[model samples]
Target: MTDTAHALAASHTLWELVGRRAELTPDRPVLLQGDRRLTFGELRGRAERVAAGLYGMGVRPGTVVAWQLPTRIETALLSFALARLGAVQSPVIPFYRHREVGFALRASRAEFFAVPGVWRGFDHTEMARALGAKGVFEAYDDLPDGDPSVLPAPPADGTAVRWVYWTSGTTSDPKGVLHTDRSLIAGGSCLAHALRLSADDVGSMAFPYAHIAGPDYTVMLLLYGFPAVLFEHFALPAALDEYRRHGVTVAGGSTAFYSMFLAEQRRRPGAKVIPTLRLLAGGGAPKPPELYHRVVREMGVQLTHGYGMTEVPMITMGSPDDTAENLATTEGRPPEGMRIRIVDGEVRLRGEAVCQGYLDPAQTAQAFDEEGFLRTGDLGRLTDSGHLVLTGRLKDVIIRKGENISAREIEDLLHRHPAVGDAAVIGLPDAERGERVCAVVEQPPGAPALTLPAVTEYLRGEGLSVHKLPEQLEVVDALPRNETLRKVLKYRLRERFSA
Candidate 1:
């Protein structure tokens, strides 16, 4: 074997993998968490029913069936069901305050929205009533209420819209990321290969199934012929309990989730949790490097991170044969057939697995290069070893009088401070330099107070440019995050600075 390559395990189509593997291991447990269990055969049965139901309800190829539901078996099955019938599925967080929900619904022109009659003790119906009053009404329901005998047939041609993933708006308001069943199924297979999924591993899912990672994990596991443990909530205790009790072997979620998981584990020492958990993974944020080492020692799991956005998500990830740096630092090589490049520090991808374009044609035109690479907005480079490395981000860099400073670097340095619990660095308005760096922080318990002068003094010790250092550092209790819990909200930080 070459010194590189991580060695190819070869790639397969998303549905091809799932359908083939379902046939291979039909009786194996495909989905389970707590008391719930569905063998591959059983799960496929439910998926068939969901496909039939969606088909029966006028969901068709190119139709966007918006899902506003929970992370339960029904939701996951419904997703696959729509995929089975060539229906493009668009799911937004069900609890998004009325404005955000209305915006996404209208933006996607969503025809069918499967919302709970009640969710998290609030009335989604009430929210629906409000939006309905605005001359905008979508087909809304509480949840699925059908049985397995009502299975539907798969679509004939493969051109149907598979999924329309919404961008997290780290830099701008959310936009629709469009992918086909062909592309999404490809994504599933690509992620499975990156993670080295095996039938022996019981996958643990915590991210919302609506997002790329969660649904991708669910489908990848089923398609890979492996058991998948589903969690409806991101509760750390429940997650650990699932690990210890149910023998979950792999996990993927956001950095916030892993941070909270570690915190909860520390709260209960000597708990033999996730004993079989060989891999602990994160995406969405570049947390401190210490997080990897901590997970290795405390949780008995190998910590890995990846590079993806809601747009061209899951193209790069750490592989099974990766070294420590390869695992924790760079996002692994572009998945199977994926193509990527870094021009002017902006990362862009072009491949079949990549999304076709955003729902808006103008936005799509703005996001891609002339030759058609999906501009990923992240700042990264490919390593000599063929791995993809994200340094900072193009949109997140702060420029002051032609001196470009990385907000990630400042955030990383701030996190190194013992008293700092969490920090978010952003660029706000500036009269001369075009933009100025601002540091918003949440302090650790009993942590010493951090002021602007102290932050400047610390950066000065590092010999950073005075202007490059944050002009302002405000201590706060929380920072806003989208469904993925990313902290690159330059918009809010800008308003805060202006006010």
Candidate 2:
């Protein structure tokens, strides 16, 4: 990290970081969207005004405020405004519907709720009203604004739990992950340092800003004094123009994002997809080595994947200076304060970046080990070089005939096949075998149709163990993915294919 960033990282609160960055680079742009730009000075100044506005509405320090809005300049302003007041924030993903939103509002006991009103056809305000949400307000195009003089002092304490983020909740109801300002700062610092970002680099947020990565990426920009383009609704082809317009140097959300860019590049082979694009970096889902090599060779860019969760925003991240072998096979290394432990092959983490705990006391108790390390439930081992090699999740291990089969191992091999665009290996219920291995694949455009026999034959040619071979094959147009990072919804696949 640069000296400026290191110094800025010492700030006790997000509002403090914003103020310091604005003081240092007031003229520099911090956010860009559709010809609109917000400089550091404007960010701090406007956020304070918004804080004053929110204060007028009776939102005081420690007041619980939940917001479900799209990724817009106004959303950041509102969030920072809340931060300025030291109010506890609960950000609900805009993609979430009644059940999730209601659950979050009720769980957090929010005193205020910010919604986009009517966004992308759905009426968020109406839904909030239906759910009997408190302090419902529309903050889509116009946010609350008041004189900065009316605002109270910004937050000083960073260790207090001030943020509640929801897990994807693939299998069950989403868990409310609690985070503090310092934990979020540590997470973003790790990301900014690992990527070796500079002020000259322009980043892009193609995912929902409501996700935990919202703060993670925002802190990186605040530290580095760079700007990132915001995409309210990210889709290929349509969003490509904005990326080109902003000259995004770093673009990625997850492995799925890498694949999306690769697919776009294939549409116009030999031509740079985004001319200014230099690196694709993200971490939410597993990254296949074949995807890494293909990205480097085909897209002509460095692809750095990482290990992160809602609990720990950034556990490990691949460095651009690392070797190709390590970059391709490992999830890089944790920063100085992060400690990684492996017990019975499960990756455990203990670091400042790690969240304090979940909202449920019981869940929090079960999530940590006796040593205070957060039990990740992810199976992985650290290489001799300290790079993390994640094999699979504990629930992802397939038990067929009393033998364990790694779904990630099979999925990684499947990516090498020419016709396979992406694959998800899942265990389906089988009366005889206990659980049958199922390979769900989505073939790339113009690739030959895949069959059960063809896929199994290819895996056999690749030397997959017989027991690990997928007993069932399901070819789909696309795998189910979450809106935030496009992580494949394996639980959905298990639900879909089990029948």
lDDT of each: 0.69, 0.94
TM-score of 1: 0.88
Any residue pairs clashing in model 1, and if so which?
Answer: 14-185, 18-223
Candidate 1 worst ten-residue window by lDDT: 1-10
Please state the error at residue 455 of candidate 1 in Å.
Answer: 3.4
lDDT of 2 by residue, 291-391 (tens): 99999999999999999999999999999999999999999999999999999999999989999999999999999999999999999999889999999
Pairs in clash, predicted candidate 2: none
TM per prediction: 0.88, 0.99
Give lDDT for model 2: 0.94
lDDT of 1: 0.69
Query: Per-residue lDDT tens digits of candidate 1, residues 170-195?
Result: 44467888876566655655677677
lDDT of 1 at 271: 66
